[model samples]
Target: MAKDRFHPSSRGLSHHGMLPLFSHHPVVSEFHWDHSVWGSSWLFLIVSVLGYVISVQIVKMLLSFRRRPVPLGPIPALYNFGLLVASVVMFAGCLQSTMAEIAETRWLWQRSKTPFEWIICFPMGTRPAGRVFFWSYIFYLSKFYEFTGTFILLFQKQNLSSGHVIRNAMVVIMCFLWLQFAQSLQIFVLLSSTGLYITMYVYLSLCRMGYAPHFENALRYCQIAQYVSLLLASIVLIGLHYYKEGCSGMGAWLFGAFLDLSSLPFILVVNKQKKQRHVFNNTQKGSITSKTE
Candidate 1:
């Protein structure tokens, strides 16, 4: 310049001066540890790690005291319940932040052009920011943890039957693949949100029926049925992935549908068999009384 122009450093446009990256493009700045989103995610990660450690210790202690290898039973129920609560909390926090962002957009004097707006609106095609990527990675890691627990139980021969081992193994594989898919930015929103809820409902229902807290013949049948359903659902998901231009819409719907349908027959068949057994017992008792009389 003929006269040295005094360019303010705040704009970060000076070729000779160094400025923080955020000053240049605040919307697309790299997420840092200090960011509130990353801060909360780190806290959740800590909580998840603590929960896993506590659960493993409790299971080990219980195993040591038992004469025969028994299912974790109530311990798994408690741990799953705690996990459900945590997921809900995290989901609520995300929703609250999204709402706040929407509120801020409404109050803005003019729509400021930013790359973040496009990224958020079209998440499937874009690489998410560091905070989102980190949290998604953590979620996938948690899924791996679930598979690890299932594998450990199966490998230890705690689950002896072929049905039990096969079922658990299939689920472990499904979770592993799902984790990969999630990290790839394939957003089957319904499946991601409701899959855990469906699983929890089925588990709670089985527990209520006295099948989970204690292993019963009915529980075995239920477990077998679930395995078959999951296999079928996985097949359907694969088909949908190819058919829907990789959108996963049909896959998500079918996954939920199959889970709901599969659980019904398990409960019905078990209860029907239980009722038949009860009727047979009562008839035998009556016959014995008649003979004595």
Candidate 2:
């Protein structure tokens, strides 16, 4: 009954696209979320990079002489909690859109019906846009807010790792590219990333509360897992692109390719560093044990 109620031809909501709950905004009609000039790809790239550079420099200078870490009483925890809540919302919204589109079909590895149809790709026009695209915009904006972490790290007197900067810059640029090209794979990206973030932030919040802090290693593994998933998914999409005539934003494939290539090495290096640290610690412990004996 619930399924039938939402059948695209339902009486009350049939006229408008998408579920009645999300029809109010007319995301497909009212707003051109991916407009040019004001929403151009170049603009997003330039602004995002400039913003990141300026923010990082300012924060670095502010913390230059401060030896002691700035005590951020509850801000980090609260901020992460807020981000966790938003990510959960994005995941749920994207899931609903995917379900609505596919109906009873398999949600994952689902086959395409038409020459241009695929689980990820939507039609050319935005009319009756689904919940997935709507949430993609939300996710794009959320990237800007993520830069706050740079400020937090600086204040905490932590080194700003290259991986962190590259990841943030890539996401910002990629999100902009998606908006420009109307990339379909973003739904998957959004869901997977947001899900990981929820797990990560929850663990972080717990650690902040003086809970199981040793699991930080697990979080690092999870972060690497995310990049691996991203790399694999990009490869899959490259294959899927050939299956159809083509999809909107297919040009963004180049961006996706570069991002995947760039991020993977960084993640692998981090993983390697962690392994080396662990081995060094064990060796030191053994040497001390022998000396004591």
User: After aligning candidate 2 to the native by TM-score, how far in Å is the CA of 61 from where it should be?
Assistant: 3.0
Candidate 1, which segments miss by more than 4 Å at Cα?
A: 1-67, 71-74, 93-124, 128-135, 148-293
Off by over 4 Å in 2: 1-31, 34-45, 103-117, 123-130, 213-232, 275-293
**Candidate 1 structure quality by residue, lDDT tens digits, 1-293:** 10111112222233436433322233322332233643235455445545545555566556666566555555556555655664554344333333333333323312432223321222222233332233333444445445344435633445233333333333333333332322221222322343444455456657755776544554456545555655554554554445433422233234434544545565566567777988999999999999999
> TM-score per candidate, in order?
0.36, 0.76
lDDT of 2: 0.66
For model 2, state the Cα shift of residue 283 in Å.
6.4
What C-alpha lDDT values do all the predictions have?
Answer: 0.41, 0.66
lDDT of 2 by residue, 1-293 (tens): 21222123333233344463433345521334444324446765797678797778877887888899999988887788889888887787767656554543233224434312444554333222345556776787788788887788888898678678767878888887776667756766788889888888888888778796687677777877877776776666666666654445767757876777787788778778878999999999999999999
Candidate 1 — what's its lDDT? 0.41
All models, RMSD in angstroms: 13.4, 5.7
